[model samples]
Target: MAEVLFYHLDRQPLDRVLPGLLEKCLERGWRSVVQLGSEERLEAIDAHLWTWREEGFLPHGTSKDGHAAMQPVWLTAGDDNPNEATVRFVADGAGLPDPAGYQRVVMLFDGNDNDAVDRARAAWKEVKAAGHDTTYWQQSDQGRWERKG
Candidate 1:
């Protein structure tokens, strides 16, 4: 069964929190797919990942970059999983994909944004209703994730 995780981003922005999470996925030898709500946001993230760390690199690619099957991390605004990723990260208020298709589904939302919080709540209900193992995580003041549910 897939595990669905809801990450509440209040202490840090997505750009700051995402790279570390992606690094963890890589460390676990899991391929990832990051689904964004817009093409603009996808492009922005794609660029950000490239320079998120000077000494680190996360192998990722977008549609414009092609070769999806060869990328360890794939970025897209659509539902397709060309890279056959084991984990999916949904951000920027993007619609959730079927959790059954992945080993894990991570939903990251801006806790400071009312709409984002509302959407995350709805997503939590939907995923829970679908019988997926779900957990909610909130960032602490020191930028650490704390399990709240």
Candidate 2:
């Protein structure tokens, strides 16, 4: 089963919403992935996450012998996808389970444009249409999120 977390920005940049989201993912046992949008917000939040990593704010179930916490897997589109160190970070984050095998998957999205929102919804729809246990979500401009069963 794959669960999706959809957010309505309410006219805020992703930076304002991302950190709390990453924290939510950590708390809910969902691996985090960021899309290739908002480079400034992405970079700023990445650095902030790094600071959290150094300050012992990482998640539990990390694999390294002396590792402290788990950091979200930063997935930028095309050129800036995570590097080896980030792969290690993902591994440290809940031991990097194979997503294909994950029975419960939760996706967090910054819902701003219809194109992006539609794209995500379409993907999830395809998966659900294919007979997988899934849920889809979209956030409205009125600052309310709607989930599709």
**Against the true structure, whose lDDT is highest?**
1
Model 2 Cα displacement at 63 (Å)?
A: 17
What are the lDDT scores of the predictions, listed in order? 0.93, 0.43
Candidate 1's C-alpha runs over 4 A off are: none
Write candidate 1's Cα lDDT for 1-149 as tens digits: 89999999988889998999999999999999999999999999999999999997778999899999999999999998999999999999898888999999999999899999999999899989989999999977776789999
| Per-candidate TM-score against the hidden true structure | 0.97, 0.47
Error of 1 at 80 (Å): 1.1
For 29-131, candidate 2 gives per-residue lDDT tens digits of 5554444344454455455554555556443221222222233454442233232222211211112223344344444444556655565565566656656
Instruction: Output the TM-score of candidate 2.
Output: 0.47
Off by over 4 Å in 2: 4-11, 28-42, 48-99, 103-111, 137-149
- At residue 94, give the lDDT of candidate 1: 96
Which candidate has the top score in TM-score? 1
